[model samples]
Target: TNIKKKMKPIKQTCFDKAILRHRSVIETVFDELKNLCQIEHTRHRSSANFVVNLLGGLVAYCLMPSKPKIPVAGTYL
Candidate 1:
């Protein structure tokens, strides 16, 4: 209750809405890396190699940009 009292409410803006909307992409990426990519399931010969690979994969994901959505053209009758 005290924690809630100290917290201030943030005003919702376009940027906030944009961040909330795109938050799922990060969640999806994490889900893919954990479950789909099987990055955690490893059989490595060397600890150093494993760490390097893991870091490299994460860096690649961070460096890669999200795919741009294509806009659909409207037809006028």
Candidate 2:
């Protein structure tokens, strides 16, 4: 694909791996927020309740002990 060809140069660098790993972590967090945190629920009776529910999910996510983190690879040393 054209996009792949354009990205070929960057893919040759070691930083590309780190960047991809970081992006994967972000994607995983969004997925978990949408599914596990019930952030996509639309049955709320009022807009105020909806905002409260959304904030609660984000707060709960922030307080979680186990969360996504980038690995500390030896290459960074």
The alpha-carbon lDDT assigned to residue 36 of candidate 1 equals 42
lDDT of 2 by residue, 1-77 (tens): 12364464443466665566578777999998998777886898999999999999999888887887766764421
Clashing pairs in 2: none
| Top lDDT hit | 2
Off by over 4 Å in 2: 1-21, 41-43, 71-77
lDDT of prediction 2: 0.77
Give the whole-model CA lDDT for all candidates, comma-separated.
0.63, 0.77
Writing each residue's lDDT as its tens digit, candidate 1 over 1-77 gives 11256689667788677666656665677776665444675789999989987887777656666632323254322
lDDT of 2 at 40: 87
Residue pairs of candidate 1 with colliding backbone atoms:
none
The lowest-lDDT stretch of 10 consecutive residues in candidate 1 is 68-77
Task: State TM-scores per candidate.
Answer: 0.41, 0.57
